[model samples]
Target: MNGGVVTDERLQPDYEADDSSINNFEKSVSLKDLEGGAGQLPEQVHTHHGANGEATVYGDFEKDKEQDVEDLPTTTRVVTAQDWSSPDDPENPQNWSMLLRAYHTVPPALFGFTVTFGSSVYTPATHQITERFHVSSTAALLGLSLYVVGLAFGPVLAAPLSEIHGRNIVYKASLPIMMLFTLGAGFSQNFGSLLICRFFAGFFGSAVLAVGAGTNADLFPPRLRAIATSLFLLAPFAGPSLGPFVGGFAAQYKGWRWTQWCILFISIPVYLTCLPMRETYKKIILKRRAKRLGIAPPNGPAGLAAIKILAPYHFTISQVGLTFLAIGLGVAISTASAIITDRTLYQKRHRQALAEGRQHAAPEHRLYAAMMGSFGLPIGLFWFAWTADNGVHWAVPVIAAIPFAWGNLSLFISTALYLVDVYGSLNGASAVAANGILRYSFGAAFPLFTIQMYEKLGTGWATSLLGFISVLMLPIPWVLFRWGPQIRAESHYPTMIS
Candidate 1:
């Protein structure tokens, strides 16, 4: 039986019965009688006799009575549901006005920008930091590297918490904590204090990164999610790119301390942005509505269910591990000739399908940008290195950085969309959490060893090494594009949309 279609076997008349009383029973059983009341089953049963002196009975008396009850009309069930009162219910996030939706997106992006901007903003001040603390270059770099390490772990904890509480509350709680720690780092009296403070700032700041994608899913449907995702991704990539450029000037004139101060200053607006971000988690909203209406919740309080907690962790871990393998293999195999293209290309494909009357676009379509990005990454890295090696204009390598940044951004957004589309809003936060932890761990570790790699291998060879690795990873997006349907079909998790 299809979902929500109820069949009333108890009220269904049996033609084989010869008893005149059965006819009377059948007349009494109307559609209303079949659905007498919630959880009320028909007590009347019709009996039939066999010529061999055998008797058989029907009407919710079989061993599989529970299964039969499930097939009953939803109107006759004792289950509680928490859904929009009407299709146009204004409380449903999907029905929010365009202005309100835009309001929801920008604040998360700003929050992401301020936190990630701090990761690279202080790079230009590393020398000043070394001199002030009398520490080696490696030790001074820890200020930057450890912040990324904090980013990796922060989401692991925060995303899960968001699943329990709500996206708005997590933002309200985390932003201030991040701001305070950023201040601590700026005013630190010693090197140890600075590192400790920077790490804490990163940990708290990561809540936005951990949960922002999930927030987007809460607000937008699959069709519009692409644009929202592309915009949201800009912060993580653009902020890091712009930070060093801006910090270079600040480091030259205002000094190393100003870098931290600048981020803290910008944090003011980011914090204010959180004020209007209402609770967007569907379960929480439904629970609140249920309380107001004096009714039981549809699925009960979220995050307390065993499957909700465990399944998200399992799917998240699996996806992250697969991504890790792809990165490792790509690096180990070849990283060359990659270029970062606009992610809008994939969204364009989706819109095209919709225009052609296809309401459900293929999940693998999101991988289009990812495939292009895989190639772009190595090309940018190789270009930057070779240009730097030949002593070309400094601006040449700087311009070359664009492709690498673009490729990274495209890949991140594509994979993120894939996770959300496959796992849905409820579990998407956990998936993003796992991805952030692993990605940032690598982000953190790379800087720590980057200087050493360049010095020992020379810039050209070092960049070539990464280029070769990128070449190896080229197959990841390709394979997913080819086998995505089958892979998703095998998963225990449900896909929200194709």
Candidate 2:
């Protein structure tokens, strides 16, 4: 036996290992200890895209050298990672037609739409809810604030699951649960029931927001991700903004309950539409391949173990904390400018910078508009606060919100893209999870005190308080933009690769 390994009658199929396999091996095995698969013998590792689009890597650790001759199988063929029976494997999502990928992507966006819309749809109905149950405003707002909190934590659990099991199952399982609780909220007889239902609804609905980004990564590689990411990112903010607008009108006309009912009506069709979505996680795709070839799946503990596989990815505390602070400032300031039309102005500036070759220049160049947003956010907030009096035309304050909202959205999208770019695709969901918790938690607490702050201090000073805080955090994006490379160079986080 060569190198203490027994020769088998069969041999591994010929297939070129894809790039992902090399990366997986590098992540899992130390360069000094190249023996594959968890302390087993030097083994053959096969890396390939799994059935559902997840990156799946498998290693055959049970070489015949370790066992008695009688214990070994008499006949076997080592299936290559790309053993798809043919080149254009119908089972491989990477090989799917673009039309099919679009079909898969739309459903997650719609799911994101419905859940995010639900987060604030009941916000305008707060007065009705308070009146119906004889509750105080703070108590009434639990319905909204708690949902925001759910949106924050849901990703902590859901993102890891998508990384493990694939995206479709999370959608299928979580959507129905979210729908059920939403319906319960609609029909609840008391404030307590409504509060409980809304919180759980947010909990379940959050799966789409948490997992959809990963699914997008699964469908579109880095070069093609920008448009899809824009659409996906817009849904979360757009839903909250639109929810209040629709719920305000609907609550005034059809009553508060109709707000919940309308969400259910829209959500049902979206749920049904997503049922046929093919699984997009590559690990799952490869696992299916193993099953077809009569090979055992990878040797590891399942469930939580699957998530632990991603633990090697690391980011600096500066990246997490600074991004969180920046996002919180943007969210708080954007609340004032929800309906502002001028939000696109800075985006136009950002686009101009890109046209001027900033895109090819450096990743930090993407933050030009974000830097502008820092100045504009405080301006918008102070303007909206000071001018938001009954004596003034409503349009004045509304106009003020434009710059603030524009700045907030621009900064947020840029920061998000920056994090995703630096962290790389495999770690994107986890990277987002770190910042999302802070942002959503802040978002939840901000509204609970918004009306109280406005009423107590008047709109001018109340908004000024928020604007002042925005000023404190204003230097974050700018500093990061100017010296980001230096910070990244010194930090433990992965550097951006072109």
Candidate 3:
């Protein structure tokens, strides 16, 4: 007996059974004996014995002995190297090496820079597009406005869908759609057709803008997320700034039609380069792997599928209301600033005259003076509204727009960084969803009222109304800065501090 147990009648050798040996043993074991053994012991006993006659059992079966341990199927979990770590899995995406993450990050940043530039590249082309399409200037401007409108709404679907399917699918799918629609916009024969195509282009292009932020959250840790987000923010704003520069020269030399074609040409190689990048959202990737292994469904009330929809809503209804409120006020202030600038300049001469006479102006005069002269939006809105149509140059109203755009971008940068800082790795799809809702809703509604506002009240008084709204909404950011900790404490979403 090589390594066997000596029983009353025979010695059962502890042979190292390969597949063939196990099969032979199964054939030799009688059904009646197997059934009888099952009641008394395991159907099969796997024993290992040392040369010194020490015996050990590898595992035990209970309740049914007829079934040999060798007959039972062993489940070999195909664990990835990353899954070997703890469930909190700092070694996961959150703890990925800096170099590995930068590889994922840089491409999206490039993609983002390109996409954002595309968004407003048409701004300088508005004059040319107007002439080409035989439409009013305002109608041609709608092409740009509609693109933003698409951006506003694209995230509702793209963000939710990306959560379900993974960021890669959304990114890859939307990029091509964006490229196609952008190309189509160049060929449109009429204003309606051009506006429709441009809108969808913006909508699909928004997938990159909305999803890139989430992708960054998927890669970087909490402390590093802010810097990543800031860099990301720089792309969109910087793109907008640079876009006009390119568009100005393009419109000056190449036709406006060439502008759309130029962007399309630039994006083609970028789309091809992104094809190899793997999905970064952990849940989607793991769930996909688990499916391939034929595992039973995971145990949890909030299953993976539900997370796609629930997570963003959880973040939005909870953390982002203040952010949206702040942004909305900022937008209102911006629109009003155009009107305020005109009004303030008209009052400038009156105020100077009053100063020379040494006459006391009312408390409201100082308040009005403070608002008119300051770089602040509330003042600009108050001034622009009243004086916009009072023989002021169109440049004055447009220049007043500078502060609103600057302030809106600044507030957006701060709020976005704050959200990323507080949310960390969990910020991916949820943050995208929240931001999509916040930005698009405002983007859509803001432009619709802007012209109507200036037309009704004259730029001066129209802006003053907007300034009042901003004043009323000013408490939102203050509250967030003060009570954000308490709000974070109460949130169910994974927060950085936790």
Q: Residue-wise lDDT of candidate 1 within 1-498, one digit each (tens)?
A: 112211244422232454554433332222223233324443445434333222232232222344654444322121123455456656779889989998999998888878878877776787899899997543565576457656755764566567667788999999899889889999988998898788778878988887787788888989998899778866775666667777778888999999998898889978997897798887777666545323445444233212222343333434433322332233212112111222245456758889999864676775666787777788888886688657465456555656665566456556655665566545553454455545644543343345457668877898889888988887898998888888778777776444
Give the Cα error of residue 40 in candidate 1, in Å: 32
Off by over 4 Å in 3: 1-91, 94-97, 299-498
Local distance difference test, each candidate: 0.63, 0.61, 0.55
Q: Rank the candidates by lDDT, best first.
A: 1, 2, 3
Off by over 4 Å in 1: 1-81, 298-498
Lowest lDDT block of 10, candidate 2: 1-10
| RMSD vs true structure, all candidates | 21.9, 20.9, 19.4
Error of 2 at 411 (Å): 21
Candidate 2 lDDT score relative to the true structure: 0.61
CA-RMSD of model 3: 19.4
lDDT of 2 by residue, 1-498 (tens): 122221221213234466654433322322122222234343555544444322333334343555554443333222333334334555666568999988888887788778878866776677788899997543555576556645654664566566567778999999899989999999999876886688678878888876676677777778987777667666665565567668878888998998899799889999999889989877677676555443455543233213222222222323322323433344444432321312354345447768987553355655665676788889988987777644565456556655775576556545554665566544543454455445644543343344446557865687799899999999988898778878778767676643
Instruction: Residues 21-81, candidate 3: write the lDDT tens digits.
Output: 3443322222123223332343344433444323222222342344544554432112331
Clash numbers, per candidate: 18, 16, 20
